[model samples]
Target chain A: MADAYESLTDHEDDARWAYGTGFSDPLAGVDTTVPSGIDHEDLAAYCLMLGDDALIMSHRLQQWVTRAPETEDELAIANIALDLLGQARLLLSRAAFVSGSGDEDSLAYLRPASQFRNVNLAARADADFAHLVARLLMFSSWRLALFDRLTGAADPVLSAIAAKGVKELTYHRDYAAQWVLRLGDGTEISRGRMRAAVGDLLGGSLVDELFAVHEVEERLAGVAVSPGGVKEEVLSVWGQVMRAATLAEGVGTTAPAGGRPPPGPPPPPPGGGGHDCAGGAFARAGSAFPRAGWA
Target chain B: MTSAAASTAATVAAGVADPEMPMLTLGDLGILRGVDEEPGRVIVTITPTYSGCPAMQTIRDDLTVALRAAGYREVEVRTVLTPAWTTDWITADGHDKLAAAGISPPGPAPRRAAGPVPLTLVPRASAISCPRCGSPETETITPFSATACRSLHRCTVCLEPFEHVKEI
Candidate 1:
């Protein structure tokens, strides 16, 4: 509306919001001039990895905008998408600072596909309804675990983002877990498809475990984070969710190797394949549906 | 940076707390990021808690009226999409407000999340202890609050039901 007006001068000179004054630098409590004793580049890159994952996932989730199976589901999906978008914004901003480049909007809209560092899981489009549930359940479990660890990161900004993310991830996990249980325990058709979906998660390259924090972790020693290390804890909780819901436990109980450093980038995490249009990963698996035909 | 203007403006802001979580003012929620006055205009900048919070419009409208009622002419409010707001922004006072409102605020905003405490889970603080009874025995009957500000929680110890301000 302001742009449609006669001149740029007609619009208010202030960049601040007129109707929504919610983002008043919530980090006012901390000395945000710079994170204390942390490598900005590594922190920024780490943030990008997490941010891009959330951004892509949010983009992918937006496909369900009006096509959700039910009205409640539509709201739920939008809610989840918004949550992801929120994470993306925070992470992207953090990354922009680290990289000394553009801010969130510039990075989100300008970056090409390959430039994005989100694991394949986030980039993968929405699959069939059942597959979407599987991907969400798996991805949420993994990310929730990662964010859970990031809440203790050495960087104040990253810690702040992670602290906020814990709430959102908890919701995402709960929502996806509920869907998995419903589909797994519902009708015969639902049950069968759910089984296949769960089975697909077993060995999709992400089977071994993954950790991209090598540079960051090594630098900060105790400050950096590794999603790969918490694989067991995450899987254990995820397994319980599945078992409690009566789904066929495709994964066995993993022993708790708590506090061990994660191995090298082990494949991508779950959700890295099934709907990957970029890589040839699941090209042959489910031609039953086109690549995210939701549109 | 007029002290008189800021004091009056802050009072107007005092009327504007988070719509979803009424216990904390927008200032307390850390969502009411910054306020600026130029010529005859007042600009209030906000960051949405989530992209599609159903009450965003309500919050927007309330900000407008709150500023106008506070006696600011040509008031404007805008929502910033970047630097997403987080639970860590919830101030210590905000936590107290949530607790007073019967919602257990998030545990201390993780200081060093890279190696945070393991039992990490931050919900809406729905598992809040009852303000009346101080028991960690509460249940959320409805996720969405009646006023888009408070959820209905029933406490077991006091056998009393109350409204808990939903945490952002």
Candidate 2:
């Protein structure tokens, strides 16, 4: 058997052993023609929205690498982060290909925070493990539902990406859901923390933004999934999981009145209106296809 | 080029082992799609196991090296995305190879129905047996493991920890 680890040290191109060291095109050699009737600009913008979400959320998960409570948890979080990062690379590459803009690196790193099109939930720092799992449970469930529908997207590349994502997201959503269950039912202290985490997220306006309809989603029709459409099914699944874990009912389905809102939304994208997903100023306030990133 | 030349290139490409799971060849792993030969150039097609699979680059490099050493002037590795890869593609021989390496081979890939995927709070019971003791009484230690494609598990009878290739 090849000593895979040992061989890495002796390999001539040892510098390229780790991920991110050598940046080859993730979608190299695949036919990237935009499907007929799909506006390339709209498609590129849509890719940024989804790609930015995965990229930013992946960053959030990566923060847990060395700090997770156990070695197993660290591995799990790191793997999940890697999956999201992989999805981010593909989506960002597609966006760049369609937009005639910079490559994935420039789109991911060169842009300022205000230019990122991710939702507020992805950008927030996890207060603790409970908060992390709570956010993960919601994020994975929502993304899984969206990707499930995207398998039939009008764009073949998007459809292919979503098809592959469905399998991985299945594992991700289940991982977070199981953690919520364990933490929510473990001990008095653990249950309190889990409940508080769920409450803070659900009671805030950021959760509502996940379900809001964005203009790009409206224009893309069959090619994109409106977050609003999947909200019901996602909530239903979350409700079942929360109930089993003995958390409060009706928490994440909706937010309470006078709840805390995120920061204000950035100015609309060029040629777009004032229909940003986040109503107020949030660290990341752009809608699904907000033009702030482009500006 | 003659079919004989293409056959030789295919044999070389097929023998390249996976970087992570060295026991399985690229063919056994089901990532190698096709091998075509021209006068002085050969084109090889492969599909990634995952979008973010880090091993893809290494796999490409390994295939190119193996083919070039076999007297090919040039080698081109292409990737395909349609009909995304599934663990079900692992050949019958691949399953035996994984078992021999102390890793549990995946069972049949789950066939999904049309519409929304149902959410389950707990893991669905899978028919995975221990590779070492051949005991069926094994439980998953964690769904995520050393690699994106595997899960950590422990056997109750033999009490040995092993990795199981996930059924995607």
Candidate 3:
């Protein structure tokens, strides 16, 4: 450890994982040159959209730490959080590389809430273990499907990142699915809690936010997979898991129609279910996990 | 000026132990891809074990430091992502070292299939032997542990908890 004076002169130590700064450039050594036909701006934006989702969701999951019911389960959730954090770092670094702008740190910490591209669900607080698993199930299902398709994206870097992510996301989805089943099909009280969690988290136009295609996705045709493209696949897995858990497929309410973001940039209006609303500020404010409260 | 310099640099770089698992060298772990020497500079290409493996920076720093100590003034450690790393890359000696250290080495990695990953409620049962007792009666306590590439398990025979290098 460096003293205050030494710390000022030697910033290298600041980058250590514990210090939160000096992560080796996640994309270092990997060729980041934008392919001939792809637009750098569009590629950057697309990366953020996915990166923010992972970053925000990872932060949310980290809140579970010691709060998890079991020691092993706590480790599992923390592992999942780390996996998503790694993915977020890669994607954000990719974005910074192509955009000719700030680096991963700047993009993550400097951006305003309105500028954050994650779906709202990623940032929402979970009520309990059931809600956490329910959200994880939905989030991982969509992301896993999207990442599986992204393995073949036109951009080499994106393709590589997605291919690696597929393996990690598989474990994440499996963990969530297992928990959902355990709670939803167990004793009546457990079943009721699981069902209520699904209804509260997955019900109401919230999920539609995941499928709504944004302009950045529209612009980056081959380079990006539209969220809408993976909708059916994500929904299928969700339905399968829900039914097997003995929970209602829809859990009661369907996503309200007519809330889809209007195409073109400037991002969806704030009211847009998932992608809009709380930005980085909302996430930052919530990051101070009250340990006492959890205990 | 000679190819021998590149091989020497490679030797030095490869000899550096993984910060997390000192029992294994980067070469044994299959992360040290290659070493190219030119004039006064050496370039080392390596791959990460996992996407979020926090040890990447330390590995990079260690490689640079090792190469520099071996008389190279300029060293560059490059990370490659394609041909994503798998436990299968761990060398024979690496596995032996892990077992000797009481950490069960990984089995064959699960082969990935095309299309969306099929969701399963139960972990696929794998044949893991006790590193301490060599009993094939080990069960997974959880699929995750202190790091992304390892899982927690307990040997029913010896009743000892151990970390297994996960099959990616």
Candidate 4:
């Protein structure tokens, strides 16, 4: 082994070490070509929406690092956060690549809160453990559904990223669901808190924004998975998890209005009219993409 | 440096052992992609097993020092993410090294077929043989372990708990 090491490392000139320092481009050899008919600017904006969501949520999860109830839980939450950070890194990089300006770090750190496009659910302040679990359950379910569809995307990079995300998000969703079950069925106080969390955090207008389609999503057509398309799948899975926990669907004090479109006609694409979210403000901006809704 | 010299440099870098799993070198783990020789610097490419692996910095530093000690003046390490690293890349020697170190090696990569399936309620344990007693009658203590690639398990025959390298 020492001989092998000597032979491999003895060169005076710059030679590749098995491992080296500095940043290596994760998408080094990936085919980053945007699909035909897909606008580069639209793709970049869409990536920001997805990447910002992960970046913000990862930060939230990081807040739990040393404060979790158990050492194992701390590690698990940290791992989940790291997973989201990884996804954010990739998506942000892709956005940079598409836009022809900025990089992952710039897009992530330099952007102001006003420029952020993540949903409101991800941006809220850290809540109690039950609230966090409830939020995670909903977020992971929705993201998993989106990623599952994104695996078939026309863009190879997006497809590859989604393929990897599916596994990680599966575990993430499972972790949150398990916690929901434990807390909801654990004790009277625990159950009450869990119930309040789901009703307060996930029940109202918060979820409605997740299903609203933006102009970027609509323009991408077959290239991007629309939030509205995955609404049923996301809701069904969430419903099953809640039912198993013995929590009533839509049991919050507030009416379950705003998040999802009513039984009638689909509201015009998010920027159409009377869309109260910040997304409308973004749409009014030079960019075709609408700003994402917040909590 | 000549092509032969570059290959030699890569071999040396590959020999550096992983800080977390010392028995297995980066080469054994298949993370050492290649070594490129430039005029004044050596660039090495590697892929991380997980995004937040704590050992990556250590491995990077170790590689730089190893090359410097071997007479190389400059070294640069690059980490990539695309074509994500998989457990299936562990070399045959790597598996043996893991087992000898009392860590059960991983099985094949998990199958990810298209379309949805029922959510997995119970955390599934891979059918891994115990490193201590080679016992098949083992049970998973937890789905997670100290590291992202491992899980806690105990051999039924030996009654000794051990770490199993989880299939990614």
Candidate 5:
């Protein structure tokens, strides 16, 4: 072993895994040209929708660092958050390229809550461990289903991003599913909490909007994978996981009270009534985890 | 430039070592896709081992600096995400280097079986052998590790902790 280790010590000082230390452009060689005929605005909006989802979801996951039930779980959640952050960077960069807007940082930190196009599920305040698991299960399942089809997108960058995401999201869904199963079947209190969290999320329409196809999505037809196209598949997978977890399948089946946003309306700017739909701000304040940079 | 000059440029770029796993070169890890010399400029294309790999920037800079020091006028490093990088891409030499460094190399990429969703489970202990003791008595310490591409493991025989390159 000593001899073998000695042979492998050729370049020991290089810290290859450090983040952003010697940073360079991730999209260095890739062509960012907007394909002919596709509306740049539509493409930009679509990328923002996806990017915001990942960014907000990453923030929510970051809340779990150092607070997870186990040390391993803490690392796992952080890893998942980092994965989403990577996806957000790529997608946001793509959005910036298409829209000719400011870069990813401008879109992520500069924009306010109301301007975000992510589904309300991701932006919700941190909840109990059960609620977090339930939300992750729903979000990862849906996103994975969507990404599976997106690997074939007409846009090469989108296709590449999706291809990378499909693998990460697969692990995310499975991780969440295992936790849901354990909690749902573990103890009386744990089971009840898991069930209630699932009900509140599904009943609240936090995930329904994800299935509602946007006009920008429709306009990009061939280039964008339709959310509606994957809804049935996502639902079916969710149903399976619920059954496996012994949780109720159709706890909340009501249509969301609001109608879908009309097509061609300029995307909503950051700031509005929809920002605090579920008392998310209050929950954030009440949580044990320190909320510093996130707010 | 002649074909011989281009080959030399490729060879120089391939020698740039991975920042994290210093034992392996970008070429050994199968990340160095190509190095082309055009007049006074050199373009190096590489694919990341994992989507969130932080070493990419360092690798890019290393390539630029190494080539510039070797008489190249301009060096451009490019990252390509398509044909997603996999552990299977790691060259045979990379496997030896990882093993020599007391880290277990990866097995085959996980098979994508026919299903609505692929099952992601913890890395199986049976598939990996201890790099330190060369013992098969190994167990997964955690599915998460210091980097996205690796997982923590313990060798029951050697009683030492090590990281295994995760199969994507």
Candidate 6:
């Protein structure tokens, strides 16, 4: 073993060591070729939004690090978070490179809440593991649709990121879906919890999805993910998944969220934990991705 | 053998399995970070397939051995864990290697999870030219591939669903 060390010690200017540093041509890369349409600035903003989602979600997932019910679950949550973090790092780094911002650290640590444009879905942490799965299933499917469209982004970098994310999202959705089915249909307690989780997690934050902040969407409309391209389809996918799981559990496909008409019109029922009891209310909007500090 | 080779020298590449997809090799995914050869030891540097990937240690072990077989005998592998890895690391050639293995090549999407890594429930055409047919007309069959680094895709013309190596 010492021989290996000594041998390596003699080899200065180690290319291998250099490779790990991620040094490379920022503009010219395998995924750098821009498609016919795409505004560089829009691409930058789009990347920032995506990076923020990953970074924030990863942060939430990290909270579950040692608090999981089982060892496997602990590792599973952590792993999932790590996956998101990895994506956030790359996306943010790419965003910084394009925007002339610093890097991932600056964006992740320095930015405040409102600056982050990620959907509330990612920003809101679940009250329980099952809630997490319910939220994850919906979020994953949406992302899959987005990534699928992004694969063809006008910008090579965006396209490349989407291409890879398509695969990861698929699994992320599937894993969450599986859990959704399992928990959603498992037992009375499990089902009740699943219902609560779904209700708690299913607040619509479509405004973020409907509008495109960066010009990238317009520039890469045909090539990169276009607004509204996969939204409906992905929603269908989630619905189908939820139905399938519900059917498997021998339960009605859709029931009033938690067996009651969600809080609408009228106000909370005097401190009964009603209305304000996490039925319709969701997270406050904020900035999850800021300019990165250092790469 | 030279003292460089014999003086407790060990070369090992972190053989970390890509976290998203555990089956493929880091080389296949193009995320084996770096293979460092130091005197008396070899240090393998690797970034997770996803920043939050569950199995970075395995990659480190694999990298360690890769170097050991090549030349060095002793090994010390470390996870760079910073700057992270991305689909950009998946080389054009590496994509082919993955495809040839029937493992699907990654593209367009950086195979590794990136910041706020966007997910896809729907897919549009990306520049993922089919590795088998070199046709850009490909569709994503499954957003998730058999493994994390790969997304299941089918060449429209070929009518075959193949694995695409994610750029991560």
The docking category that best describes candidate 4 is: incorrect
How high is each candidate's TM-score? 0.63, 0.88, 0.87, 0.76, 0.83, 0.55
DockQ of each: 0.15, 0.62, 0.61, 0.20, 0.37, 0.11
Model 3 over residues B1-168: C-alpha lDDT tens digits?
348877888889889999888999998898887788977799899988878888888888878777777789999888888878888999999999999999999988787576667788777775889899999988989888877888999999889999999888
For residues A1-295, what per-residue lDDT tens digits would candidate 4 score against the true structure? 5777666556542235433334444555455778777789988888888888898788777767767878767777878888898788888889999999988888877775567788766654434677778788889999999988987888777877887787678878888988888887777767776776777665446687789988788888766899999999888888888888877654565332333322121122212234334333322331222244321
Candidate 1 lDDT over residue span B18-118, tens digit each: 65666678878777777777778787777666534545555666777778877887776665543656667777888788777666555443343443223
Between prediction 1 and prediction 5, the one with superior DockQ is 5
Model 2, A218-239: lDDT tens digits are: 8999999988889989889888
Q: How far is candidate 2 from the true structure (C-alpha RMSD, Å)?
A: 7.0
Docking class of 3: medium
- Best first by TM-score, ranked: 2, 3, 5, 4, 1, 6
Q: Ranking under lDDT, best-scoring first?
A: 2, 3, 5, 4, 1, 6
Candidate 1 Cα misplacement greater than 4 A, ranges = A1-31, A207-217, A249-295, B1-7, B16-168
For residues A1-295, could you state the per-residue lDDT of candidate 5 as single tens digits?
4687554453543433353334445677887877788888888888888887888788778877767888878888888898998899899999988999788888877875456677776766544677788889889998998888888888889999998998888878888888888887677777766766676676654566778777788789888888888888888877777877777554444221222222121112123324433345423332322111111
DockQ of prediction 1: 0.15
lDDT of 5 at B77: 84
lDDT of 4 at A162: 80
Best by lDDT: 2
- Please write out the lDDT profile of model 5 over residues B52-84, one tens digit for every residue: 676777888788878987889899888889888
Chain B TM-score by candidate, in order shown = 0.66, 0.97, 0.94, 0.94, 0.93, 0.63
- Candidate 3 segments whose C-alpha is farther than 4 A from its true place: A1-21, A249-295
Clashes of each: 35, 7, 5, 14, 3, 126
Among all windows of ten consecutive residues in candidate 4 chain A, which has the lowest summed lDDT? A261-270
Q: What TM-score should be assigned to candidate 2?
A: 0.88
lDDT of 4 by residue, B1-168 (tens): 558668778888989988879999999998887788887778888877875565676677788888887767899887655576788989999999999989999898878675663465445554878899888989976656787667788898899999988777
